[model samples]
Target: MNNQEQNMKFMQIAMKHLPEGKKILDDKGIELNMDDLQPMLELLLNVMSEAYELGKEESMENKS
Candidate 1:
């Protein structure tokens, strides 16, 4: 997929699990405002994208 499509997919996945992330923070008695949330979400997306790339590379190596 293109970069835009990959980013969109990452966002969808992140949003889907957002509630779970919030729950974890709530259990820890941590609260985040919008400012904090934005960076956290960006970090999550970056990590997810890197992980996806790593897995794709591994799969290609295995196929070879």
Candidate 2:
């Protein structure tokens, strides 16, 4: 697939898992403050990016 298709696929999968991410924070009593939401989102995206890369690497290894 092309880069755009790959990105769309990634986003579709990510959207499905996002609720679980929020649930984890809710369980921990982490309240979402609008004032700090942007930074929190940035942090989440950064971590998710690293995690996706690691997962992609592992999946490629499995295909070898």
Candidate 3:
């Protein structure tokens, strides 16, 4: 597929997880109210950020 198509597919997959934000937070040891999911979503973002950074660091190490 073309770049645009691929991007759209990836975005769709990502957005499907919007409702699971709280589940992700719960799995990662972040407690939050079920009524409000933003906190869990924020925690998920923090987790993804750290994971991405770690992945980049590993890639750099492998290249060296």
Candidate 4:
């Protein structure tokens, strides 16, 4: 289990989950079309960015 092997395995598992995730979203009435993907990914990225920033701020406060 070298780093490359581990990374490949992780990616394989992640790829398998992608369709399951899309299925879940589709069941919830979300669209998976090309027109919808951009906005959907953008929204997810924005949320992840905000969450990362919040976590960083919390870590800084804890260190003070």
Best prediction by TM-score? 1
Pairs clashing within candidate 3 = none
Give per-model TM-scores: 0.86, 0.50, 0.53, 0.58
Candidates' lDDT values, in order? 0.90, 0.69, 0.65, 0.66
Candidate 1 C-alpha error for residue 61, in Å:
0.9
Alpha-carbon deviation at 12 in model 2, angstroms: 0.5
RMSD of each: 1.2, 4.1, 6.9, 6.8
Best candidate per lDDT, number?
1
Q: lDDT by residue for model 1 over 1-64, one digit each (tens)?
A: 9989999999999989988888899899999766778888899889999999999999999999
Against the true structure, candidate 2 reaches a TM-score of 0.50
What's model 3's overall lDDT? 0.65
- Model 3, C-alpha of 22: deviation from truth (Å): 7.5
> Which candidate order results from sorting by TM-score in descending order?
1, 4, 3, 2
Instruction: State model 2's lDDT.
Output: 0.69
Clashes of each: 0, 0, 0, 0
**Candidate 1, clashing residue pairs?**
none
